[model samples]
Target: MMKCKINLNPKMLNLLFLISYVLFVFSLFNRDVSDIDVFYSFTIFAKYISLVLLLIGILAGTYTRKEILWFIVLLCIDFILFIKSGVLVFIIISLFAFHSTKIEDDKIIKLAYFTLLIFTVITFLLLSLGIFNDALTNRWVGDSERHTLGFYHSNVLPLIYSYLVGYGLSSGIYKKNHYMFLIIINFAIYYLCGSRNVLVATLLLIGSKWLIDSFLQKSEFKKMINNILCVFAKIIIPFLSMISLIVPLLMNHIGFFQKLDFILSYRFTAIYKIIQTEGIHIIAQMTNEMYFDNKIVIDNGYAFLAIRYGIVMLIFLSAIIYCIANKYSDNTFVLILIIIVACINFIDNDIIDYSCLPYLIIGEKYVLESFKRRGNNYE
Candidate 1:
C-alpha cells in the first residue's frame, strides 16, 4: 500500500485564514442590513463561508497534545450547551479560538484593522449620504434620538470605534496626535449616535494610555504605575464579573444600586429580570421569551456570560483572559487595554465578539506563543 500525502502551502493557508477573518469582520457591518437583499445575502454568505474555511484549516493542521486537550475540554462544554440551548455560539467560538492561534498575529491584525476601518468609513459615508437606513430610535438614554448608522444598534458603531482605538493603543501603531484626533472622532460618534458608555470607555482607554506613556520618563512613577497595573491586571476580570453579577441582585433593594442601574440604562434591572423569569442553568439555556421591552437583550457583558451562557462558561472565559492578562502584566499598554476592555464589558455585552473586542486576537496570539515556548509536552 502506498502512503498518502497532502502538501499544504503555509503562505496559501495563511492567506486563506486572513481572507476568512476579513469576511467574518466584513459581515459584521451588514448585520443590521437584513432588509437590503444584496448586502444581507452577502453578509450571510460571508459568515457561513468564514466558518467553513475555519473548519477546513482546523482539520488540515496538526494539534499538539495541549491543544487537543483544550479542544476536548471546550467541546465537552459546548456539547452541554448545545443539548440545553441548541445554540452553536460556544462551539463556533471554540473553533475560532483554536484556529486563530495558527495564523501570524501581525497578518491577522493588519487585515482586521483594514477590513474594519473600511467598513466603518463606508458605513459613515453611506449614512452621511442618506443611502443607508438609519435606526432612528429613541429607546436608549431616554427620549433622545439614537442613530444606529446601519449597525445592529446605536451602541455597536461606537463600540467598533472603541475597539479600533484599543487596537491602535495595543499595537503602538498610532502616534499621540492620532489618538488625540481619535478623541475628537469619538466625541462626534457620541454626538451623532448617543452611545455614552462606549464614548466614556474609549476616552478612559486613550487617557489611561497617554498618562502611562507620559510617566515612562519618571522611573519612580513608572514603577509605581506598573505595580498598580500588575495588581489591577490580576483582579480586573473577576472584579468586573463580580460587580456585574452582584449589581443586578442589588438593583431593586439598594438605593446605590438603583442609581447605578439608572446610570447603566437599567442593565442591572434587565439582568435581574432575566434571571428571575428564566432562571439559571449549569450550561446555557436558550430563551424564546424576550427579557426587556419585547427585546432579547443583555447589555451587561459579564452578566450575559454568566446568566445566559451559564456560570461555567463564564468562568472558563474569564480564566483564559485572566491568564493572558497576567502573562503580560509588565506590558503597561497591554495591561491597560485588557483592563479597559473588561470595564467596557461590564457595561455592554459583546466580550467575545471580535468587532467589539479585537484585542482578543492579540491575547490569543500571546497564549499560543506562551504554549509553544513550553514545547507543548505538558498535560
Candidate 2:
C-alpha cells in the first residue's frame, strides 16, 4: 500500500483551514448590495479562492490509499452532477480525513471553535447596526420580520448558530464550567431566525444528552442501546436513501402526512413536485431549472440530494456520514454531535455544508486508526 509521508506544518494547515472555513461561511450570507452582479462575482471569487487555499493545504498533507479512492469516486459523481463546489469541498474534506490520523484532533477543533466565535461576534455587531434588515425583510416568514444576522436567508441562520452553541457547550464541558452565556446567545439567535426546525434540533440535542446521562445510568441498559445503535448505524445510509424515495408516495396516500407537511411549511409538497417532474432514477440528469413551481427551494437535504444526484449518490453520501457516526460511537460527545447534525440535515442543506464536513472526515479517520490498532494488537 502507498503511504502518505508528507510532513506539513500543523499550525499553518490549521490556519489555512480556519481561513477557508470563514470564507465559506461568509459566502453563504447573501448580502443585498446595490450592484447585484458585483456581489455575485465577489462571493464566487471568495469561495473559489478559499477552496484553492484549502486544496493547497490538503495536497501538502499526507493521505492514505482508501482516502484517495473515495476522493476519486466522489469526484466522478460530482462531475456527473456538474457540482463544481461540491467536488472541490469533498476533495478538501478527503485530504483532511486522510491526514487526521497524523494531527491533533483537539487542536483542529479548538481552531474551528475560535473561528466560529469570531464570526458570531462580527455577525452580532452587524445585526445590531440594522445592516441586515433588507435581507431579513425579503425572507418569507409569515408576516413577521425575521433577522438572519446578515445571512442569505433566515432559515439557515439558526443551523449555523447551533454550531456555536455546540462548540461553546463542548468547551464548557471540557473546562468544567457551565456556559450559560452561550446558551443565552443561541436562544437569542433562534428567536431572531424564527426557525422551528433549528429550535427543535437544538433542544433535542440538549435533551437527548440529559436523558442519556440520567435515564440510561445502568451499564446493562447502556450496552443494549449501544448495541442496537451499532447495528442500525451499519445500514442507516442505504436505509435512509431508500426511504427518501418512499416519502413522496406516502404523502400522496396519507392525509395526516399532508398536514404534517403543511406544518413543515410545504417541504413535502416541494419534494413531491420534484419527484413527479424529475422521476426517480438511479442517476439523475443535471439541470439548471427549478424543480418546483414558482421557485420554491428544496428545504430538505435528503430530498435535495435525491433530486440532484439520485438515490445512488445519496446512498454514497449517507454511507460517508454513517462511517463518521459509526466510528465516533464510543465517544459520547462525538456521537451526540453527529446525531445533532444528522437531525438538522433532515430539514436543511447542512449535509453538504462546509462547517460539518471537516469534522465528519476527521472522525472517520480516528475510527479507521482505532480499527487498525485493534488489528495490530490481535496479530
Candidate 3:
C-alpha cells in the first residue's frame, strides 16, 4: 500500500486555501459574462480551480495509509481524468499528492481526494476541448466567446457566491446593495437556464441541516421533534410563502428581501417544469450505454452511480454515510449537504458535475469536525 503523506509549511498550507478562494472568486465574476452556454463554461472552470486547490489541500485533511491495490486502481482513474481536465493542473496536484505527507483520517478522505483529483482533470479537458459548447451555442466553426483566453467565460458564479457567502460569514450583515440585487439576478439566471437541480439541492441541504441541528440542540425527545419540525418549517417557509403570495403577503411578516423570497416561492413551479421534460424515457435512453433497459435517472448523483456502477459500488462509494450518521448526525448543515446531494443525485448531470462525490468522500472528516466543534454540551 502506498503511504499518503505530504509535508508542507503552515504558510504554504494557508496559501493553498487562498488559491482555492481565488479560483472561486474568478468563477463569481465570470458567471454573468457574455458567452454562449456560459453557465456550463463557468461551472467547469470554477470546479477546475476548486479541484486543484483540493489536491493541494489534501495534505491538510485527515488521510491515512493507502490500501495497496485499490489505491493503484483509483490512481489510474485519476491519471486518466487528470489528462482529460488539464495536464498542467493535473501535474501540479498529482505532484502535490505524491510529495505531500498524509494527515490522519479514514480511508474515505483518501479516496475522495483521489477521485476529485481525477474528476477535476477529466472535466477540465472535456469542457475545454469538447465540441458540445460550440454546438450548443451555434458556433460550429469557431466561437471566440465560447472560449475565454485564460480559461473559459468572462463572468463566473463562484465569485458571486464568494461575495455573498464571504460577507455573510465574516460580517453578519449581507451586502444588501450587492447580493440584495444579486438575489433577483441569480434567481432570474436560474429560471432562464432551467437549472432547478441546484435549488432542489439547496432545499434538501437546508432541511437535512435543520433536522440534524434540531435533533442535537434539544434535550428531550419532544424538543428534538419540535426542532426537527422547525427544520421542516425552515424549508417549507419558501413554499408557504408562495401560498401567501396569492393571499396578500405582508412585508413585515417574513423579515426582509421580499422579492428574493418571492422568487424562492416559485420553486415548485420551476421544479414541475423540469419534471415534465426529464421523465422516465429520457432516463432509460441515457442509461442504455451502461445497462440494458435501465430506466434509472442517471442525472442524479445517486441514480447515476447506481445504474452504471450498481449497488455494490454505491456502498463503497458512499461508505462515509455511516461515519457521518454515527458522529455528526446532529449537524444540520452536513445533513443538508447530504440531503442536497441525495435528492439531486438522480435529477441533474450528477455524473459530470461530480459534486456529491467529494461530499461523500469527505463526509466522515466533516462530520467529525462538526461534531468536535459542537462541544460536549450538545444534547
Best by lDDT: 1
- Candidate 3 on 160-233: residue-level lDDT in tens? 22223322312223332443453454455344333444444333333433444446455456446544644542
lDDT of 2 by residue, 296-319 (tens): 457777777777656765766656
What are the runs in model 1 whose C-alpha is more than 4 Å off?
Answer: 1-5, 32-38, 104-106, 128-131, 139-144, 287-294, 361-379
Worst 10 residues of 3 by lDDT: 154-163
Arranged by lDDT with the best first, the candidates are 1, 2, 3
Over 301-328, each residue of candidate 1 has an lDDT whose tens digit, in order, gives: 7778776677876676666676667776
Q: What are the TM-scores, per candidate, against the unseen true structure?
A: 0.85, 0.77, 0.40
Note the residue pairs that clash in candidate 1: none
The clash count for each model shown is 0, 0, 30
Model 2 misplacement above 4 A: 1-8, 29-42, 63-78, 81-88, 99-101, 134-145, 170-183, 210-220, 231-240, 287-296, 363-379
lDDT of 1 at 20: 74
CA lDDT of each prediction against the hidden true structure:
0.71, 0.61, 0.38
- Pick the winner on lDDT between candidates 1 and 3: 1
